[model samples]
Target chain A: MPQISQLPEFYVSQIFWMLVFFGLTFLVVGRGMVPRVLSTIADRTTRIAEDLAAAEHARTAAEAEAEAWAETEAAQRARAHDLIASAKHTAALATQANLATATARIDAQVSAAQARITAARDASLGEIEWVAADVAQDIAQRVAGLTISADDARAAVKGAFTHG
Target chain B: MHQFQIEKLFGADWAIAGHSIAFTNSALWMALSTLLLIVFVAGGLQRQVVPGRWQMAVEGFTGFIDGMLAANIGPNGKKYVPYIFSLFMFILFANFIGLVPLGLIGLHPFTFTSHFSATGVLSVMTFLIVLIVGFAKHKLHFFSLFVPHGTPALMVVPIFFIELISFLMRPFSLGLRLFVAMMAGHVLLEVLSSFVISGGNAGPLLFAVAGLPSFVLMVGICALEILVSGIQAYVFVLLTCVYLNDAENLH
Candidate 1:
């Protein structure tokens, strides 16, 4: 083993080189390697955070849009429902008014039919009475043929009408 | 290769050596550090949400790294978790590997060997890179990093020069910290083991006497090794983060 005291000039050069090595290694590792690694880590973290925030914003916006759509859809449905009800109500009222007018016309037509029936029955009854009177006058004329005097004939007719 | 200490150049105890190109015991431990980093990180990354044993261990480490960076820097400082975790793993691995007993410089066949041949070009290269990171982040502010803020303009030149000295000293400090820690830990372990082995030839009474203290110390140092492993790694990363913060947000 070469003691520190006995080490020759070559050993001194080795030490000098070692020191030089130290300076170079630290410079490269510290300046080049470490900074690159650290920056990458920072960049990754920042990118992740930014992506999450953007996703969150998009989600919230989508939710708000969905809510607005739902509201509009509901309003449209309500409008359609109101229109159908109004249409139904108007149709029902129109049908009812039509029925009422038809009923009035039918009533007027039935009353006219009844008046015609009554007038026809009274005309038929008058016709039957006239026929009966004619038949009685003919039978009385045949029986009173023997007496030809105007006063007698008139008296016979009156007597016959009274007996019948 | 000629070795000359900086004490001659700078007239001080803290000196620089030039022309030494061989790997030291510290370099061996540092190379071993990669294995630790790989094992821990690969294990951690492969974890499931509901962790297994390996996953739990990795999770514990990851959580610790996260907590440390967050507390010291800011909650967002978790961005530095992988780097900090890797830094911790390397240091911890280096410390543990350093605990292995060695016969001589670069002679041990095990990865724990501190032999000159074991240290590679790659490990030293990495140290330079870390320092550069501190430099790049600070830029002009890096010069000011050594100089405290609020100093008057008249003091700026002297302070700037001092700051430059300190800034230049970072890599050395970092490298030396790992090297010294590894060297010390291994020496202690080796010495204790030698005592245990030598005592085996003595009488049972003598064997038990030397053996007990050596055994006790070995166990104690082993525990201390674990702590040092974690602490050194933490210190490296802490300083790294502080330097980065200074560079990133200069006063």
Candidate 2:
């Protein structure tokens, strides 16, 4: 074959040119471009990783904030509940105090009214005794001409009323 | 045979000393393949965070060679990426471009990879890298590639000689594998096409029986040739990596 026969003549040029081309390829494309491309990919990967990490950080922060908010809200709720309970307790104590004052006033008014009624009855009883004493004197003088003293008659009436 | 002939282009037969400095058809194709490869790789130089189609293609091939080296040569294989990448791409481009039916357009596509001298130089360069690396790292112990790991004490000498011979044959075998595979495919296609022509002149009967089948075979072989071209380039690189394995890992 000419491939074999022609080789000795063709060798130098082929090798020379092959070296030139292959050398250029190795330098320009292989060494230069390949790394550039891979570095870009590596950059993208790191960027994505950073973004994910930032997102995770944000998520954690939000969760912590929510937890704090919940805690504060619970405290606020408890404070409000305490305020309501204390106000209710104060209102109940005030009501009890007012009821005690009203009850004392009513008891005083009722006892004073009873004292007035007793005094009136005692005054009427005194008047009734005097009337009876005068009436008896009149009856005795008009019907049988017997005279009786007011004092005696008064005493007798007193004794009879007292014993009865 | 004429298809395989190296002819001078540009109307001048120039030489430097005894060496022919004239630009030949082979040189033109080599330059063309380099330019094409550069253009292909230039797309990747955009360096976008997200790769485009051309960038992806370039990166895909780079990653493929990288993966192969990583698999074969272990951690230290990274240093040889540029050389391996260049060799693989150059061979792959030559193979694929050679299969282009440019002859139909009255233009011949010379596949330099089909030349033993071209593949020989490349394989020898690869072998040299191994040798240089092996010696640089291991010094005199680079010779241990011949003894292997598990040779019995009695047969060590014979095994060492045999291994040494086989180890030396690596580059030649590598060059021959690619060169023969490519040359044979091209020759087979040329032969069958000639059959188609000869049969046509003989008779319609022969044309129908022989020319048609020959044409069909040529078509089938054309497809196979494409596959073979890719496989051969891969095989060349794979073997280079394996040889490099001995150098880098010393296994």
Q: Pick the candidate with the highest TM-score.
A: 2
CAPRI quality of model 2: medium
DockQ result, candidate 2: 0.51
> lDDT tens digits, residues A126-157, model 2?
89889887887778788888898999878877
The candidate that achieves the highest DockQ relative to the unseen native structure:
2
Top candidate (lDDT): 2
lDDT of 2 by residue, B1-251 (tens): 77788888853577768677668899899999999989888867787777788878887888898889899988788877888888888899989999999999999998888899889889999999889989998999998888978889998999999998998898899999999999999999999999999999999999999999999999999999999988999999999999888888787
- Interface root-mean-square deviation, candidate 1: 7.6
lDDT of each: 0.58, 0.88
Can you give the TM-score per candidate against the true fold?
0.51, 0.81
**Candidate 2 ranges beyond 4 A from true positions:** A103-164, B191-221
Candidate 1 docks with a DockQ of 0.08
**Superposed Cα deviation of residue B24, candidate 2 (Å):** 1.3
